[model samples]
Target: MPNGGSRPIFILSEDTERERGRDAQRSNIQAAKAIGNAVSSTLGPKGMDKMLVDSMGDVVITNDGVTILDEMDVDHPAAKMIIEVAETQEDEVGDGTTTAVIMAAELLEEAEELLERGIHPTVIASGFSKAASKSEEFLEAMAEEISIDDEEMLTRVATTSMTGKRVEANVDVLADLAFRAVKQVAEESDGYSIDLDNVKVETREGGSVNDSSLIDGMLVDEDRDHPGMPRRVEDAKIALLNVAMEIKETETDSEISVTSPDALQKFKDYEEGELREMVDKVKEAGANVVLSQKDIDDIAQHFLAKKDIFAISSMSSSDIEKLARATGGTVVTSLDDISSGDLGKAGLVEERKISGEEMTFIENCENPKAVSVLIRGGTEHIVEEAERSLIDAMSVVSRSIESGKTVAGGGASEIELAMKVADFSDSVSGKEALAVRAFADAIESIPRILAENAGMDPIDTIVELRSKHEGNGKTWGIDAYSGEVTDMLDGGIIEPLPIKTQAVSSASEAAVMVLRIDDVIAAKGEEGGEGPPAGGPGGAPGGMPGGMSGGM
Candidate 1:
C-alpha cells in the first residue's frame, strides 16, 4: 500500500447508469419536496410568510412562492429547474410564481412514491397531465356559474392566490389600481395596446391625486428640468433602447501633442470652434430637444438655454420613444438622423411654481407617444417591499390586461385543467393513460404545497393519507397530515387550495423533468456553490438584490 505495490485503497467502482438513475431520482424527489414545502404557506391571502434568512442573518418576510424560490440559495441543478418554473410563470403572468413552484414540489413528491412503487416516471408524468385536464374541466364547470362581476369573484381570485391573510388588503388595493390603470390606458386607445408603465401606482406618504382631466396627448416623464421639454405633440415619432450615448471615450494609443504655446492655443481654439459648430449643426437640423447620454457641459447648457432649445441629458435611449410619443416629436440618437417629419409640432407645458421648483403639465396633441411611471414610496423597507410587489403586479396585470382576460385565480384554473386531462388520458391507449395519473399528481401538488407552507409535513402526511384513502377506494381526494380526507367545499378552503396545487404540480413536473436529464450542460461563468460543508447544508441566501431584477 506504500509506493511500489498498490492494494485496493477502496474498491472503487464506477456507478452504472442504473445506479446513477436511482440516485438522480432520489435527488430530484428531494429537490422537488424542498421547493413544494418552501412556498406552501405563500398561498391564499391569509397565507403566512416564509422567513428566509441567509448566512449573514438577513431575513425576508414574504408569501410570494416564486420570489422565495428565486431568492433562495439552492444548489441542486434539479431544484434550479423548479426555480425556472416560477420564473416562467412570472414571465408569463407576473403572478402565479407561487402556484408554479408549489405544484412542482407536489408533483415530485407524488412521483417519488409512484416511482418507488414500480411506476415509471414517464407514467406518473402522463397521469399527471391527464389529471390536469380533468381538473381544469371541473374548475371551468364550477366557475361558469360564478359571475365575474360578483365581489366573490374578487375575493375568490385574491384568496386563491393568497390565503385569507392581512396581505389580501394590500393585494386588493394593488389589484384595483391595476384594473383602473389598465382601463384608463385602454380608454385612450382604439386597440388593446396600452402603455402599462404609464399607470403609475405610487404609494406616497401623503395621499393620492384623483383629478381626472384629458390631455390632447400624453406626458411621458413627470418632470424635465428644462422648460422646453414639451408636454404635447402632433404626429409624434419615436425610438427606444436601453443605453446612454453621451460620454465619448478616447481610442487606445491616440495622442494629441502640443509642444509650443502657439500650437496649444491653436489646438484649444480649434476644439472650441468644433464643439460650437457641432451644436450649430444640430440646431440647423431643426432639433428642438437633444436627449444626451451625459449631463451637458456649461457652454452647451448655456447655449441651449439661450436658444430656447431643450436638451435633456442622461436619458436612456429606450425612453426616447416615450419622450417622442408624449411630445409628438422625433427621437434619434445621432442628431444627423433627424428629419422634418420626425420633428412633430410641439406644445407648451402649463407651469405652476411650487416652493422653489416648478410643477409643469404638458398637454394637448394627437396620437402622442410616451412611457413613464412615477413610483412613490415611504420609508426604505416599506418602499422596498411595495416596489417588489408592484413590479410583479405590474408584470402580471399588464400581460393579462393585454390578453383581455384574467385566468382563474389561486390556481383553480390549472387544477380544473388537470382534471380534464385525466379524462382524456383514460380514452387513450397504453402509455398515454399514464398521463392521467401524472396530471392528477400534478394538480394534487397545489394542496400539498399549501400543507407544506403551513408547516405541515407534506410527504409523510400526503403519502400516508393517499395510501389509506386508496385502500378505501376513495380515488379522488385530498390528504391531510392529520390523516383526514375532509371535504374542501365544506371546509371553505377551495380556491386557494387549487393555487397551491398548481404551484406544486408545476414545480414537481419541472423538477422531475430536469432530474431525468443525465447530461450536465456546462455554461460559462455559472456560479456553482461549493458542496455542503461537513456540518450541513444551510438556508438560502438573502432575497434577490433590491429593484426589479427577477420579475417580468
Candidate 2:
C-alpha cells in the first residue's frame, strides 16, 4: 500500500511477539528454575510443606512434588513442561518427583553457563545424552538385589517413603500394612510383579491410625439388603451375582394392559412365581451369603430372608470382581447358572458399624490374592493423608520387588552416581566433556537440597558425602534426623533402584529437550475482540489470529 497501488503486500502483524537465541533459552530456563525453586523446600524428610489455596478457597497442604505442581496454577509454557517432568516421574515411579524437577532445573542452570561460553546447543544436548546413558550404567552397577520375602528390607523401603508425610506418627504401622498388602498381590511367575489395583485401600475417620489393619479379604462399604437378612454369617458360602435380583423389563418400551381384575391377578401370580423361582435357584446353590452388583426386588428379598440368606445388593461391579478374587467365587450373571461350585468360601461375612455407618467385611479367605488395608485416623484429613502415604509406600514396595534391587536413599545413591559420572566425563574429549561434567555437577543438587532442608551446611555436607563416596563408604547419606552423614542402608533408608534411575534419566531428557530450543514465538491473545478474518492475509486458517513467527 506504499503507493496506494491495488497490488497487496504482506506485512507482519503488530501484535505478534517473539524471542530468539539466548533470550528465548534464558526465558525458558528462568521459568523452569522458578518452578524448581517453588518446590525445592519440600525435598527431604526435613522439608516443609506447601499450603496451596485454589481460587475456590480450597486448601491443600502437602510436600509431595507432583501434588504441589498439580495444584499450582502455572501458566508459562516452560514451567508447564517442568511440571510434566514431575508428572511423568510420579506416574512412572510414584515417588522422587521432586528429585526429578530439581535435577532438570539444575541441568538447565549448568547448560545456561555453557550457552554463555559460546557452546552450541546441539553439542550440549549430545553431551547430556551420553551422560544420561552413563548414569544408567552406574545406577545398575550400584544397586543391590533384594528378595520380596525380606520383610525387614521391604518395611525399611516403605518407611523411607513415608518419612516426611503426615502419617509419621503411625509410620511403622502403615509401613507394615503397605508391605503386607503389596506382598499379598505380588505375582512371582517370571519375576516379581504387582498389580496395584489388587491392593485396595479403604479409609475411615474417627479411629486412631493405630487402629488401621490389613484384611485377608475385601471390605465393602455396604450393608445388608433387607432388614430380615442375617447380620453375620460364619463359614459363609458367598455367591457373587452381577445380574439383578429383580425381574427384567423388555428391551424396548411396551405396554402391559390389564383388561379386568382376573387378568391382573393372573399377571401378579406369574410375576410372583418367577421371583420365587429365582430365589429357589439361589438357595439350591448352597450359598449362605449373596453379594449382588445390581438391586434386589422386595419380593426376592422376602424370599431370601425366608431362607435366612445374608443378602447385600447394589454393590459396584469393581467391588464384585474384587470379591470374586478374594473369596474364590465365580460371579454368576444369571440365577439359573448359580451352583454349589460357583460359591466362594469365607470364614466370616459380617456387617459391622464403623463411624456410625454399617460396612460389610468379608474376611478370613483361605488364601486371598487381593487384600484390603483399612486406614483409620482421628480426622478425615489425617485419614486422607494416611491413604496417600500408604499409596506411596505400596508403590515403592512393589517397585522394589519388581526390579529385585534397591539402593540407599537420603541422597546416597545420587552422590555415588555423580562421582562415577564425573570419572566417566574425564575420558571424553572436546567441549562436550565440559557439558558432561556439568551434568555430573547438576546431580549434586539432590544431596545439596537434602542437607539444606535438614538445617545442615550444604557445602560441608556435600564435601563430606563426596569424601565418603570417594573412599570405602559408598552408601553414606545425610541422616536428616541428626544432620550427620551416615550409611543410609544402616539407617533404614532405602529406595527402589528404578526411582533414582528414572529421575536422572527423565530429568536429563527434559533438560536436553529444553536446551535444544533456540527460538520462542508466542501468539498474541485473541480475547476481548474478534480474531483475524478467515484466510485473511497474515492470518492462519479458520479465522485464527496469526502468532509471532521468527527463527534464531
Candidate 3:
C-alpha cells in the first residue's frame, strides 16, 4: 500500500463494534421468535405438547410453554430475556405462563424492524413503559363493572378459568363445593382457615355425597403393625395385660434354684396372685380389651375372658400409640400399673352426604377445620394431569375469589383501552403521538394472539380485523400476521376479545423493552468458564457502540 499498489492484506473497515452489536440484537430477536413459535400453537386447552430431548438423551413431553422453555436450556441472550419474562409471569400469576412466553416472542418480532432503522432501544423501552401504564389504567377503569357478587358470575369465572379443557364434569359443581366449604369453615369457628388443603374435592363415580360424615377427632394413618396387616380398627379399648408371670428372673432362660425351701415357696405364691391382681387392676382402670406383645399364659387369658374382657395378642408399639391418640387415651404397658386416669375416651364416627360427593370430617380434632383434598382418577397418568390442573385451578380460583374481582375474559378491557387511545391519537403531543400510535398498535395484538391460540386465523378473522376498525363502516390496517385486510365493519365483527387485550398488553411490554438496549457485553474467558465479574458504566473501558453504556 505504501508503494501505491493493492496488497494481500485488503482491509476495508467500517466499525466492528457497531456491526457486532447489531448482530447480537438480531440474534436476540431471532431466538425470541423461535421460542414464541414453539409455544404459540401450544396455547389453549387443546394445545399440543413439545417433545424435547436433551444432549444426554433425556426426553420431556409437555404442553406447558414455561416447562418447554425451561427444559430447553437456552443459551442465546435474547432467548434468555424471553425466558425471564415467562419466569416473571409464572412467579406472579399461576396461570398465563404460556401467554407470557408467546407474547414476549411477538414483541421481539415487532421491535426488530425499528432496531434495523437505527432507532435506539432505550426510546422504544420508554414508549413501552408508558403504553403499559396507560393500558393498565384503561383496564382498571373497565374492571369496575365485572363483579363477583352473583353466584352465576362466580361460575362464569370458573368456566373462564377452565376454558379449553374437559372440565365439563362440573365447573358449577366444583364452585358450589368451594363456596359451601368456605361457608362451613367460617360458620364453625372464629379465625378459621379457608383453604383447598382443608376442603377436598374428590370425584368418586360411585361415592355418594350423602355418605359424608364428620369424625370427632384427628385421623392420621398410624399403622404400627406389619404393612400387610389389617388397616381398620373398631370398638377397641386400652389393654395393658403383661404376659410375664414371675416378678423376678435370676438368669437368662434358666429356672431359678432357691437356697431356702420356704423362700422358694413364697416366690411361687406371690407370682400366682400378682398375675391375677394385674389383670383386675387394668379392668378397674376401664380397659375393656388387652393387647400383649409377649405370649399370654392360659390362666391369665381364661381369667380375663371370665371377666368379660376381650384381649388381642401381639399388638405393635406404634399401633398402640396411634390408638391412644385416636381415643385421647394413653398407652399402658403393665396391667398392674394401670389407673382410671390412664384411660381416655373416644366417640362414634358419624356419616353425612351431599350432592353425591362424599366427604369425611374428623370430629373433636385439635383443629376441626383441618381437611385434605383426596383427588382420584381412573388411571395414574390421568390423575396426575388432573392433579396438576386442579392445583393450578385451585390457586387461581382462590385468588380471584379472595380478590373479589377481575377483568372480562379475552382482553376485552384492554381492547377498549386501545380503542380509547386510538380515538385520541390525533390529540397527543409531539414524540408521544408516535409513541401512543405504537402503543395502540401494540395493544391491538392482544386479540390476534387469543384468536390464533383459539385455533382461528387471527389475520383473516373478523374479531382481529375489527380491532383496527376506524368506524363509519371502514377498517383498514395490516393484520398481526402481516396480512392486509379491509372492510372489517362489513364483516359484522365487533370488539376486541378478553384474551386479546391480555396478549396485547404483554406483547407490548416485551417488544418495546427489546428495542431499548443499545449495547450487549458477552465476555468469555480463555479458561473455558465464566468470565471476570464486572458491573455498570466503569466496566466498558474500551467504549461501546452508539456510545451506549453497558449498565443495562
Best-performing candidate as measured by lDDT:
2
Model 2 clashes, total count: 0
Candidates 1 and 2, the one with greater TM-score: 2
Worst 10 residues of 1 by lDDT: 534-543
| Segments in model 3 whose C-alpha atoms lie over 4 Å from true places | 1-20, 51-62, 144-149, 166-370, 424-427, 460-513, 525-552
Q: Is candidate 1 or candidate 2 better by lDDT?
A: 2
Give the alpha carbon lDDT tens digit for every residue of 1-552 in model 3.
344565555253322122246655665566667767767776654456677788998666556556677786544455566777777665544456677676666556656665666556665566566666666666555442222344455445554444453433544444444333433333223322235444444443333222222333433222221222222234434453334432545666777578998998997777767767766776777765554555555666666666655554554554445445445565665555777676644332222242343222223433334333444445443344444455444444444454444554443443456676665557765555555666666555655665565566766654644544435222332232223343322321212123333444556666666555546654442343233222211122212222223211
Candidate 2 structure lDDT: 0.87
Can you give the TM-score per candidate against the true fold? 0.63, 0.93, 0.56
Counting clashing residue pairs in each candidate, in order, gives 76, 0, 27
Model 1, span 284-316: residue lDDT tens: 666555555445555555565555555556654
- Evaluated at residue 329, the lDDT of candidate 1 is 64
lDDT of each: 0.49, 0.87, 0.50
**lDDT: worst 10-residue window of model 3:** 533-542
lDDT of model 2, residue 219? 92
Look at candidate 2 and give me any clashing residue pairs: none
Tell me how far the alpha carbon of residue 497 in candidate 3 is from the true structure, in angstroms, after superposition: 14
Off by over 4 Å in 1: 1-23, 53-59, 129-173, 180-289, 333-340, 344-370, 405-407, 410-435, 441-552
